[model samples]
Target: TKTFVEVQQRLDDVNSKLHETVSGAREIKSFVTELDELEKFDQVNDNYMKANIKVHKLMSLLDPAIVLISNLAIAAVLLVSSYLASIYTGEDKVQLVGNIAAYISYLQQIILSLMLLSMIAMFVSRGEVSARRINLVLRTVINITNPENAIKPGIIGEIEFKNVSFSYNNVNENDDKLTLNNLNFKIPKNSIVGIIGSTGSGKTSLVQLIPRLYDVTSGEVLIDGVNVKEIDLEYLRKNISYVTQEAIIFSGTIDSNIRQGKVDATKEEIEKAAKLAVADEFIEKFEAGYKSPVNQGGANLSGGQKQRLALARALVRKPKILILDDSVSAVDAKSEALIKDNLRTLKDMTVLIIAQKITSIKDADYIIVLNNTGGLDGFGTHEELLETSEVYKEIYNSQLGGYHE
Candidate 1:
């Protein structure tokens, strides 16, 4: 009990501090999960402490009260036998001594039996209480709302966000405040739009809502003219392929990683996708070629190689809407340019590229520039935005001296 309580307290303290430091909602959730687990351990310790106290009290009564009374009874008999022996000096004295000795031996046996029974009772009580505690923890309820009256989204690639607002609890309104507020946007079918934002401008949050990672607090996100909340989650997600900024490549060969998207993809299709993503050159460099084993998260691979491999994985899915959430940020300028060029060749595909650098999205059909605050400061093509948007001019001047062709 002591050890468990100490460990629980330590974990809670450390995770609480971590919760304060981490800004991302995902990281905050992980810290909260850790805190919850520690609280459960603390509850178990509480139950164990209560049981230990009860057992201690019972032991005290068995040792002091019952043993003391038995010892007093034995002492009184010894005194009486000694007095009788002094009064009568014969075989009667011997018989009296034998009876006293037998009585003392019987008393010892009774005392030992009582101690044994008391110990058994204490252990049984502890067991029963521990069982109840474990059962309570197992039966504890978690708060997760269920979906109601949801419909299938079909294969439509339409996406829209209307008057969306979101806020987390216990954060400062003046400093680290609301991420997105009253935001409105639409992604038209077969249109390639790019979302550019400074750090913490809710870029990830905005795209995350398309897949309903989080429901908007007070507005609606619609897919194919149907509210996302009304659509079946599985059906909606199957049509969208999202490659995140963090390229996650599991420990496997190049072929295995690409085949992850479509398990039934043929060797020819896999090779074709790799070529399109510019991953073929690097794969061939390895001695084992396509069969070379990749380490966890592709740790051994270069940054550009990982990005290209992730692109291959996403391409193999042949999704209706491709959402690249800063997926090409790690690759070189030339490699990113190749991927961008390849994106243009995808027929009937709706692509959304979220990037940091302006060069990454210069050729995009439309670029939406987000300010440090949660608001859209500009939205247009590279040429139009440069001519009209102040933020775009500043970005252009800050990076490439001017928006030169």
Candidate 2:
């Protein structure tokens, strides 16, 4: 059973890789030589085929072994009974025959019981392996959880990070390697803060801490002057709406998907959110309008459309804090500008925009610049950063095609 489990795992891995390869076959053909790509695909295919063959072979042997054992037991019982009956005289022979019949019946019953036991053993072995896998998942301890006396803050959107540091590895806090180094920053209430950095600069990691998605290795993230770890988990998350870089849509009507943000939202409110996100224009064009069906993961929608819908979903919630993690990258410049304009109307809510493009965040109230080494380079307005931060200045010049001065 252990051997079968290991083989099954390998087969699953190979099948998953093969599915990915097939889905991206066009891209592979465009970038890779045909022969080389075929060889790689064939190797994975061979592994799957071999695993399948082995399973079939095992089934064939097991079934035949059970049948052969049963047949042999029956033949041995009959042969012994026949020989005993032939050697006995008149009355003795009759008694011997009756005894032989009883013995044969008992032997048959034993053989049937053994066959059933063999089948049960096979099933039990597989069930044990499956149960162990499920238990491993069930027994896993969640690293992030609400404290015993969690606070529920009355005020909503003031955020601060004090001398914060984080590492993916929880052990060895003294280790030199960290995803986010010691950092401190404050985002005032009802303000738009832009976070910009090169790849792997911990931009996402920093925002994730705001919601306690991960606990800081050291220092603290505070909300409304209270340590975030002390805040109730549900209360903290309910006040923040996060739209990730990749828009995730469910298999349902557009109305149903948007309603996920605010379950009891009215039709008017949903329409208002779509307009704010600049999604209503496209949605109205569809014959079904808001009732249009969205396939799984929004595969039926274009990238920009999916992003617009996600933005609408976030806006519909009227959250105290909204975080956009490169959510508008797929939208055109005109649409992006309109969305930014609409965001200005959300005066009571604090907003955080993490973007790669400088143009997307140039007009933000304050910009937080991070260096490649996971340290803060600057935190100020665009003009202030251009003058004071080399990293910010270089990025600005590269995107705008000139020196700020």
Candidate 3:
């Protein structure tokens, strides 16, 4: 919020400055105020703090360097020309020396100009160096690894995690403890598995392993009986469609963003998927229908609209496995019910929904409830867990306390 307000103020100042420039009035006050506002905005990112300070220091010294270089060059030229004229016309050389001296004044201006050009060239070299350094930082790889001779796995959507253990940077401890401790699990050929947990219960991390977003520290993640690391990375990802809490939308016609799921998907298929996700009603109301240009990150759309659109994009693919990581949290209860209702009839597709809301997955065939300490607290259906699992009962009690008479 602070960043947004600061940027808005800076933008308004910039607009006023632009108007001043166009009207032939170069207000020094406007430029200074704009520069100060920009400095405040830069503090928000802190991306170039060190480089900015160094650049400012260099700028302070640049004028003196230019003056010294100019003075030295002029002194050299004047000394040389004065000596030459004196040697050529001994006491009668006043007029000749004066003419040469007047021309020698231009020599200082030429030297200053050359110094300015050199400074510009130095700035260009620094810019290229800075660009190379930035590229080097960006090139550092994390989880993405593309292997040669990668073969595609068979069409079975069986997911298996074998003793998978994961850890992050050991800021406090010298050793890395497992966030998912010696975990072993398997999803059958065609079954919807619901993963329920409190916030930061390693739900996201566990699912991320199947997609190879993050590799297991000690074990293997398998899809379709083949380890994900050994399978063709592209083909493995192509068979799975994932949606998360934050819906990523691009700026373009709604049709274009949905096409990213399956580039060659027919219009009929797109419309069908939209209908299934209950996004058709709102989309049809737009003047351009599917062609309505969505703003970047779907800023032009409501949270519910973005979530539904993302769901529709996921459904359009008709992948072997649908991994939804709290994807419907933003949608309204009615919309969520409609989409879930449609999902009941889907066959041959394995759906894995990771959710925090117990009401969302109460009817799921299998619910794996996770505790805050990164271990499975319970695993069963809503009624099954309520009867047999204490953790599931607590979650149910917490979310639907009033409903319980």
RMSD of 3: 8.3
**Across residues 340-369, which tens digit of lDDT does each residue of candidate 3 receive?**
888888888888998888888888878887
Cα-based lDDT for every prediction: 0.77, 0.88, 0.77
What local lDDT score does residue 98 receive in model 3, on the 0 to 100 scale? 75
In TM-score terms, which candidate is top? 2
| Greater-TM-score candidate between 2 and 3 | 2
Candidate 1's C-alpha runs over 4 A off are 1-3, 9-146, 170-176
Rank candidates, TM-score, best first: 2, 3, 1
Encode model 1's per-residue lDDT on 251-352: one tens digit a residue: 989899999888999988898889888899899899998899999879789888998999999898788888899998778878777878888898767888
lDDT of 2 by residue, 1-405 (tens): 765676667666777877877778778889876677678768877876787677668766776786787678778877887887778789988888678678778877887787777677767776787788889999999989989998888757999989998998864556677888889999999999999999999999999999888999998999889998999999999889999989999999899989999999999999999999999989999999999998988988999999999999999989989999999999999999999999999867999999998989989999999998788999999889988999998888888887555
TM-score of each: 0.68, 0.92, 0.77
Local lDDT at 311 for model 3: 85
Name the weakest run of 10 consecutive residues (lDDT summed) in model 3.
169-178
- Top lDDT model: 2
